[model samples]
Target: MVNLNAVLLISFLLFSIGVIGVLIRRNALVILMCVELMLNAANLNFIAFARHSGSVSGQAFALLLMGFAAAEVAVGLALVVALYRKRDTVQVDDINLLKG
Candidate 1:
């Protein structure tokens, strides 16, 4: 039998890795990918719990989160394109235009 707790633990580990990547990485594209990874990790946990508990609510919530994540990816990619066009680089630290 598949262990639900193990699945949840793996998901949590994946999320932590993504968080660390976002905090430490300088490249915009990499950071965006890491954000997606974190979102997916949460989704995995939701679905796993939903299946284990014999309830559909968690699955439904996971689906909803997936939809939002898709939209977020669309907007985030657009921003990345715009930023790349403007600066010709994808480093987040270099984006200090609004700084005083």
Candidate 2:
């Protein structure tokens, strides 16, 4: 049987990496990837706890979270594409506010 502590530790590590990446990276694509990593970490936590407790609620929540993440990615990528088209760059610092 897998240890719960190990799973939790791995999830924490993934989340930490994602947070650091988001804070340090300036590229819009990289930041989006980091956000996805963070989401996956949360999913891992939910699944691990659900298995440990022998309950499906956590898994159900994880599935719902996945749907939200998918929608977020779709919208985020659209924004990034729009930004690239307008600014000709994907660097976050180079893009100005939505104000025209």
Q: Which stretches of candidate 1 lie over 4 Å from their true place?
A: none
- Top lDDT model: 2
lDDT of 2 by residue, 1-100 (tens): 7999999999999999999999999999999999999999999999999999999999999999999999999999999999889889999887767555
Q: Return the TM-score for each candidate structure.
A: 0.92, 0.92
For each of the candidates, give the backbone clash count: 0, 0
lDDT on C-alpha atoms for all candidate structures: 0.95, 0.96
1-100, model 1: which lDDT tens digit per residue? 9899899899999999999999999999999999999999999999998998899999999999999999999999999999999999889999998995
Residue pairs whose backbone atoms clash in candidate 1: none
Q: Which ten residues in a row are the worst by lDDT in model 2?
A: 91-100
How many clashes (backbone atoms < 3 Å, residues ≥3 apart in a chain or on different chains) does model 1 have?
A: 0
What does the lDDT come to for candidate 1?
0.95
TM-score of 1: 0.92
**Candidate 2 deviant stretches above 4 angstroms:** 98-100
